[model samples]
Each structure stands twice: as C-alpha cells, then as structure tokens.
Target: MPGYGAPQNNGYGNYGNTGQGNGYGASQPYGYPSPAQPAITVGDGLSWAWSRITDNPVVLLVGFGLWTVLTGIGVEASYTVNGVEHSYGLGIPGGNIISLAAILIGPIALAHVGILTSSGRKASFRDVFTFPNFLQAFLAILLSRLAILIGTIFLIIPGIILGYLFSFVAYAAVERNLGVTAAMRYSMRLLSDNVGLLLPFALIGFLLYVAGAITVIGWIITGPLVALMTTYAYVRVQGRDVARYPSQG
Candidate 1:
C-alpha cells in the first residue's frame, strides 16, 4: 500500500484526519507551467487507474456502491417541452437536493478511501461521510458548475473549455485543501499545461460515462475507473509520482 505524497503510516487509525500535504497548497501559487513535468499519456492514466482498482477492489466497490445508490435516488431525468428542457428528480420531492449532495460527497469519500487503502489502513464504508474542507469544496464545485452553465448558455464551446479548465477543482479542494478560487485556479493551471496529454483522456472518460449510462451495472466499473483515472491524471499533471502496483512492476 503506497500512499501519494502523504506518509505511508500516519498513526491515525480512524477517518478523523483528512489526508493532506501532497505538495498542493496556496503557497505554491498555481496558474504557471512547470517546465520539468513529464508528459503523461492516456494509456498510462488508464493503466494506473485499472491497477488501483484491482489492488483496492473492496474499498473502491463499497464506496462506489454507496455513490450509486445516492446518485440513483437523486437522479434527474430531463425532457423538452416547447423547446425548453426541464428536469426533475426520480426520488422524493427533495431528491434533487440529495443528488446534488451526492455529487459533492461521493467522490471526496472515495478519495478518502483511496488515502486510507493507499496508506495501508483498512477503510470502512463510513469513510464516505468524512469530508475535508467541506465548505470550500462545496462552494468551488457549485460556482464552477454555475460558470460552466452560463458558458454553455452562451455557446457549447465555452462550457466545454470551462469544463476542462476546472476539471480538477474537486480534487484540488479535497486533496490540497484549497479554497474556492484557489481550487479553480489550480485546476486551470493543470489543464492549461497538460491539455495535449489530457484531452485524449477526457475524451475517453466521456466515452466511459456514456457507456456507464447504458446499463446500471456498467457504472459499478466505469464510475470508479473514471474517478481513479482523473485522480491519477491530477497527480501526474502536477509533476508528482504515483505509486505503481505490483503488477505494474
């Protein structure tokens, strides 16, 4: 079990301590290119993601299961009426709220699981409830979504650009403990520097998302795969090293 930038064993048995100090910080001043960062390929990202999944199947599956249930309950179906598109949640009246919450909480929980398992600690499904920088992450994600939506209203291209630019905002907030503006800035720098390498990976992730949508069970695999892949890309793009599994050896 190899953790990212954090120590392998930090002595905290429970999920109380949020994993931090991964070379991502406000002090570093983002939005600049790192000249020495190596190029990462789409194959490398997918391979790393698959390796992590195989190595930590139980934790990943458990987390993904929780995410799926919450996400499904809060799932929204959209339809067009008189050239206007509208959506509603499938669950109860406030199901949309639950769905929005799921989007924010699910991935961070999975990242916590990643931190635990990678640090050689056994992770519990309850780790999904542990959120670090909750307010910051929530605001960053909300604002980014709103901005992307506004861009989309103007034209689809700006939305896609904004999507790519702020793709790693959640990871930045969760892993780096960045504030709302800092997280967006960090993500923008990462994307701007690695667009050549990251574009293909994003395209593949989109395909996986579509594939996952076709079947309920498909999400069990693709959901975590995409999450892990994005996490891997985040680390690599930042010029940090990822732990290679035994099979990758």
Candidate 2:
C-alpha cells in the first residue's frame, strides 16, 4: 500500500530482457535451456540465501526482530482475560487477533524482503507492511493454512506434500497480485512442474528448523535464511535470473 515503487514484472509470462539471471547457473536467454546450467539443489538455495543475508544482515535482522517483538506482544495480549489469569474466553482473544494479524502479514513482508534482496535492490523495514493486496494476501494465507491443516488431519504425508506444494502461495499473491484461490492454484501448478528441484529445499528447511530449535537462537538466522531461499526458488521457477548469488556445490 505504501509507495514501494512499481511492482517488478517477475512473473512467468513477462520473461523478456529482464537481465536477471535464469536461475542458479550462468545467465541464459528466456525460454532457452542451457546444458551447462545445473539443476538447482537444496544446498544451492541455502547457499544463495546465506549470501544474500550476509550481504544485508541488518535489514533482514531488523525486519524479523520487529516481527518477533510484535508476535510476542500479541501472545501476551491474548492471555489477559478480564484482568484474571487462566480465565477462559468464548471467542478468540484480542491478543490472538494481534498475533494473527502479524502472522498473516509477516510472511508477505518477508517475501518482499527476499524478492528485493534477490534483485539487488535496497530493501527497507517499511517493505514488511506494504502489501497492496492485503485482503487477497490474507485470504490466500488463511485458506492455504486451512487446506494444509485438513490434509495433515487426514495423514501426515498428505499434509507435508500439500504444505510444500502450496508453499509459494504468498510469493504468488505478492508478486502477481493474485487473489486467494488464484495464488494457491498458481503455487500448485509451479510446484507440480518443478517438484523435483524444489522439494529438497523444503526438506532442507525442515532440517534447519530442527537444528535451529536445538540451538534456540539459531532460528534468527534460519528463519530469514529459509525465507531468502524460498524467494530465490520462486524467482528461478518463474524464470527470473538469480545468478548473482550462485548456488554452492
């Protein structure tokens, strides 16, 4: 909503002389395949993310740190019940409302951060709350979470599969300005085509989460690292260039 500048045309349809790299390898013309361009791997995603974070740790750290503080405040607000401790509520608490607002809005902001950083542009803390299509982004996230929850209820594997499949919903919503259903559908389509290249990143992210949990403070790095990696994958899958930070072997 804020003056975040015109949206970059990074979608699959407008892949012209954008000058962004094709993916993890050397730059190639749009719609043409290069034999030398190696397939993107989980390590590539992580490495690329690490490079971006190291390049601009302050922006990423400040943005995520603000998110964490707001989330904590929301958590604290939700527990107050008529000024009594452990009191029950018939509906969701006000603090939960704040927390939910943060959760719904935070990822979109993080996505913008990753997108801008990948593009080698200056990303500011204001980028976090600058969603032009806030309603659409919110519904997109809510429905995707609901779908994932339902899938997990049926079976753990289905949930995981659906989770990865719809993981790009926020990117779609932010980048393409698509509505809830369209964003989810777009994510599904992209992942379906590139599941082989993308699934490992999801697995790697899970492992990172596990490792971060062990260290407790490790997620400050892992959290933004995963966001950066996912954005890189999204840009590459959409045919944008990301060779500036090449994936490591």
Candidate 3:
C-alpha cells in the first residue's frame, strides 16, 4: 500500500493509469500535516507493530496464523472446458480465508483492547477468546474486509482510495459496535480526513511487512505487525471509549 506515494513526488500518479494513483484521493482531505510534520521512523512503526504482536501473541497468532495458513491454501477450484476440465475457480486461500476470519474476530480484538485502552492501554488477548464472541470476531473480520474490498473496486482510483480510506475499518467495527457498512464508511471518513498520514504509515507497514514476508520467519513475525497496526489504528482513531460490540455473547 505504501509502496506508492504523492503521484508527483514518487511518480505514482502516472503509475496507476500510466501506473495508476490518479490524483485519486486529492479531492478528499488532500492535506497532510505541514512540512513541519516529523517523520514517523521505520523503527517507531516496527516498535508499535512489535508491541502488538507480543502483547497478544496467542490469539493474534491464532487469528492470523489461521489466516496465513488459509492464505497459503490458494483460492482456486477446477472447472470443465469443452469436454476436458480446466483449472480454476474462486475459493479464497487460507491466507484470505484467515484474513476474512479476522473480520469476525475484529470485535474480539476490539474487546481485547477496548477495556484495556479505556483502562489505559492495558488490554490483552486473555479475554478476547471467550468462545461465544469468537464467531462475531470472525464475522467482523470477514465482512469488513469484504465490504472494503467491494468499496475499493467501486472505481479503480476509488478502490485504491478506499484501500487507503478504509484502512481502519476493522477497529471501527468494534469500537463503535458498527456493522460492516458503518465501520467501512467511518474508515473512509478517517482517511478522507487523514490520507497524508496513511501513506507514510503504509510505507512503514509495507517495509516491515515485506521484510517479514521475505521468509517464513518474516511472514510469521510480520503478519502480526499488520494486525497490530490495524488494531492500533482502530483504537487510536476511535479514541479510548468503551464501545460495545454487537453483543457477541
């Protein structure tokens, strides 16, 4: 996501259509903090990411590990062509399946942090996996990701726009007890208000993610970074307030 940058500076605008970015999100906030904004270092991003991975390593790992495993499973099925069968369909690999599962698990993650952040960022996964709410957590992960996916495709540029726009949709779902649509819109709103910060956040996230994904150890290590960032984004953007998930119990 961060690999691209200000169409003009990074030459991504022409990259999208010519390469795509399309001056796409400029109509939104289109404003970043003044040049006075300090750079968000690679280490800071990694630290935040690392803290999350370490904080709730178990559920986070279970949630994302399932996703990673499912991710590796591939999303194809077989079909018939003329008389002989061809090779391909659409089933979402273990990676996507796990990610999809995260939507459902989102509220759980929120509950994990909601009380903790409210109590002053002391959340852990201990209470996040109480069983009854697990399904809700799974749904939140699946639907939210899918909704955002749909929104992103609304227009190619818009899709990229939503890709960045709804960056924090999962967190909103839990913090606000929001359904998929509401949370997605909220994320879009947050990005519309803060698109500039997103690119940099993404750039850092991407670097960490790529580095982690470069190897099995990297993938295992970095997978949680993505989750942590997404979770942190949700908490920070939603603010530290006790929001109820839709009664997952």
**TM-score of every candidate relative to the true structure:** 0.75, 0.74, 0.53
**What lDDT does model 1 reach?**
0.68
Backbone clashes for every candidate come to 0, 3, 25
TM-score (C-alpha, index-matched) for candidate 1 = 0.75
Candidate with maximal TM-score: 1
Error of 1 at 30 (Å): 32
Residue-level lDDT for 27 in candidate 3: 15
**lDDT tens digits by residue: candidate 3, 166-211:** 5665445443445546556666777677656556666666776788
**lDDT string, candidate 1, 46-131, tens digits:** 87778777876776766777787786786768999999999866657777777778876666666655544433344565665776
Superior by lDDT: candidate 2 or candidate 3: 2
Flag the better candidate by lDDT, 1 or 3: 1
lDDT score for residue 130 of model 2: 65
Which portions of model 3 show Cα errors greater than 4 Å?
1-43, 52-63, 74-156, 237-249
- What does candidate 2 score in Cα RMSD to the true structure? 8.0
The C-alpha stretches of model 2 lying farther than 4 A from their native spots are 1-38, 68-94, 243-249
C-alpha RMSD of each candidate structure in angstroms: 8.3, 8.0, 14.8
Give the 10-residue window scoring lowest on summed lDDT in candidate 1: 23-32
